[model samples]
Target: MRNDIQIDKRSIGINFIDGKASVRIWSPDSKSLEVKLENKSIPLTKDDFGFWTITTTNIQPGDLYKLVINNEQEFPDPASVSQPEGVHGRSAAVDVSSFNWTDQSWNNLPLADYILYELHTGTFTPEGTFEAMVSKLDYLKELGVNAIEIMPVAQFPGSRNWGYDGVFPFAVQDSYGGPEGLKKLVDACHAKGIAVVLDVVYNHMGPEGNYLGAFGPYFTSKYNTPWGNAINFDDAHCDGVRSYFIENVLMWFRDFHIDALRMDAVHAIKDFSPVHILREIKLHVNELSQHTGRQHHLIVELDLNDTRFINPLEEQGFGMDGQWIDEFHHALRVTATGESTGYYSDFSGIADLAKSYKDAYVFDGQYSHHRQKFFGIKAEKNPGQQFVVFSQNHDQVGNRMLGERTSELVSYEMQKLLAGAVLASPYLPMLFMGEEYSEPNRFMYFVSHTDKELAEAVRKGRKEEFAAFHAEGEAPDPVSEETFNNSKLQWNLVKEGQHKTMFNFYQQLIQLRKEQPALKHLNRQHLKVSFDEAAKTLLLHRWHEDQHVVCLMNFSQQEQKIQAPTEASNWRKLLASHEPQWLGKTEAPETFEAGEEILLQPESIVIYQNS
Candidate 1:
């Protein structure tokens, strides 16, 4: 008794009825196109433009289907909105509107007030499940982090990875719980006033189980990246490829109520189109924000040092909200460890630190011997919060020959100094997981790949890659299960002496950032940094209105006496690493002689506030 729909041969299109689904695909090169249903096959009629259309009344949501192009079978639509299973498996038809959202009062937090905490879900807890992470929401709240930026959670080959190698862009990783688990996690976070920022990888898919090529021309050989052939963002049929990614980004915000997205390795996305992919993504995100009445933000990770990424689209730029300030971290690392190999070759001494603190870009318009070309541009006036600075992050720790943290390589006094420098800088500060407590464990690179040959190759390559650093001992085999186990955070360490000291230090620094009006100033013009290169000491002065604060760091091993700047005459000791008050000892200085010679402990940093 149901009406049979007749298709017009002149046009190709799809109409989703109450109980039936229609599909249309365009492939001029294919001799034939067929719809492979779960129980039957329907031949699609091709129009003059080589487009195929087919409709079936029996097909409904949750039914799986595939397309046959020129006798070659492929996965569901390349622009599939949901891959409920995995990438290599069948794609299910999902009704996105069916899921009822519980968050009606959630809104994105202001970027200036955001204190981001970057965490990897797989190793954040022993269970490594989204539900397990929910138990720790109170812990993050207590630490004063407003946003949690999770590493890539897209499905990959196995249970363990950094998630960068994810191939299924739509499917959540099965091991860390799936899409439902992620939704629950986001909802829980919103309930507690925490914003969720997902780290998404678009430059390249993992080597294993990637099937985008079988579905369509999602990649191009015109350009290549370190991972392999780059995504075909500018080639023919690229419109759909770009839409696929843009839709995924929108899905995160619309469905999960995610506030922000941190794009991974944007430098590898090679797009020469007049409207670049990043620009298009930003435009779409802004539109979505307008429609939903909720703010959505996009942060990019670019190593090119181009300010164009953060510039507005109307101003002829990429229009990203901000970028990770790797140069700031590099400067901090080089200053703390005094290691100059590899990328650190461009960074040394207090000059680089001064530039990173005052301008947020140390290599701006300078001839970098590393790239052999001028890198970066001067940030626009009042663009202080456009850069995110940190002393340590996932890449910095995991990429090392041995995953060594700043606490492992440098003394505790130096760790406190680095923390102060990062927190008091003009840019936004990000804290790596367990960095506050100075966790002794290193976060090594680990993957659970079943293929022995590929696993062995990765293990060998990781070891050989570190030969340049002259790292001692054998590199931790990334393929080994022990590698993954070693990276889990040991929460009990917080009770120990050294880790407790660092934890309290981080708490004090965060409190200072909140209370000090000078530290909250985002204007680069209001910042002044001076350093004694010969004495291995640096002083950062920040002022806004009538409030001023001074951050002094001593990098030398022996006690040194240095005269305070003229403005520091009214300085009162607010925090000190060697001060016994921070460590339960009674002997602590309440005040220091102004403009007079003061002795600094080896590798100590002190903060003074004008009374």
Candidate 2:
């Protein structure tokens, strides 16, 4: 029987075609390139389009190979689909078609319905593998989250990393079960009706094992970021470079079957071309969504407070579905914990929190004291759902001087009140892993760089980065084994003592957000906040059609009696943070009359509904 399997020659990596393997690579600066498979060398022909290609039958799936450029250096494939060996070793051919996918009917969840759970795979479980994560799918399903945003899983330099240092954008980390393990994990998530959103770093690649610079001008010195050199998106010979990263976005959605991508730190991606790189990606993803009959979303992480990132392209915007709003976290944190340092210096108390809750962006073209400039554009027309708000995330918690999470910074009652405020807001809410149950472990910055020189450099850099905060002791070594081990989540604590109550409270709040039309409708126009700065109290009112939800919170440290909102007539108490059933000592009346005064304990929130 003659095999008629055909693969696109323009594909970036090793592709199987009719019992033969066709390898294509982008190496514009190299004089020549060759593929070494099974001790046999095959020369590749370079095309005018800057791609070098060779077709050979000797290269099969699972065969180890390396790229020999200009007869001098041998490096792993830049777009290797699976780096079975370490980053410094050779790459292996992966047959993506071999994995069995059972999620034929799985579609991406709507933006309005995304209750995001952000997790770092290396620390989320003790085993720290994709297979281990599958065992906890039932727990996540019971927790009532519809989406999971995985931290970056690309191949880094060593056995462990926070994943931001990933060098090879296409290869899954070998230690984290590689491509096959990830497929099984994504499949398991879909089987449990959970959508997978992958976090990808496009601003910069890791320092070590980055060979793209050896082959071409992949970085530009025109702009600088915290990460060394910026990617060459608009510089000379950048068409090929732009295509390289854009294809990466499609690879995750097409080959890995990811429902969405969360682009990390897009503000660092500087491009001045006629069409921005972000705009190009948004246009291509829009096409992919229409062609595949599957929903694909792009959520960008930017602190510039620019609305163009989430606006529709028809209105001269980038056309992303959502953007992570760090200001929301800052406003909530400053109000809840009163930590006014660094970026937290800009936000005030309950008034700022109320502003973020109602307008989506608190710094809407306002002068920022921290930045010392007018920082953000207005987002008046944008719906609240376009902004993903979170009380605690990796950066806010992990980047701290001691890597302490919110549970350690605030009182237990304050944690519960903050949870209620986040869940009841009109914006989409995200829960950092272990945050739902107030896990005690610190999500510290950890890595395992194999190169001693590079490891020492990372340690020095970490210390210098935290110098402004005046950390008490020396910063923890990023490459230390102890740091990595200590960051793992203590999953057993989720069912013990007060932790169990917090977990159950999270579940109930998630269910209420899903069932309540007012919560899920995500209309900022209908979401109202009335805050009294003197009393340190806030009243949030949300309504859709005839259904309404009223949440009243007290941030002060003493018991206080506050007047109900004018629209609080015929309201029934749904949830109170001080109830004894939730490990508290106080409870409110089940029903209340209009204009009645309600007593609230310190750092507590009460939610009411009118049926």
Best by TM-score: 2
Q: Model 1, 148: alpha-carbon shift in Å?
A: 0.8
Where does candidate 2 clash, by residue pair?
none
Q: Tell me the number of clashing residue pairs for each predicted model.
A: 0, 0
Give the alpha carbon lDDT tens digit for every residue of 282-333 in model 1: 8777777777789988898989888888998888888898889899999888
lDDT at 231, model 1: 94
The true-versus-predicted C-alpha distance at residue 224 of model 2, in Å, is 1.8
Model 1 TM-score is 0.90
**Model 1: lowest-lDDT 10 consecutive positions:** 1-10
In the range 330-407, model 2's lDDT, one tens digit per residue, is 888888878777778888978999988977788988898888998787899998778888999999888986789988
List the global CA lDDT of all models: 0.78, 0.86
Q: What TM-score would each prediction reach against the true structure?
A: 0.90, 0.97
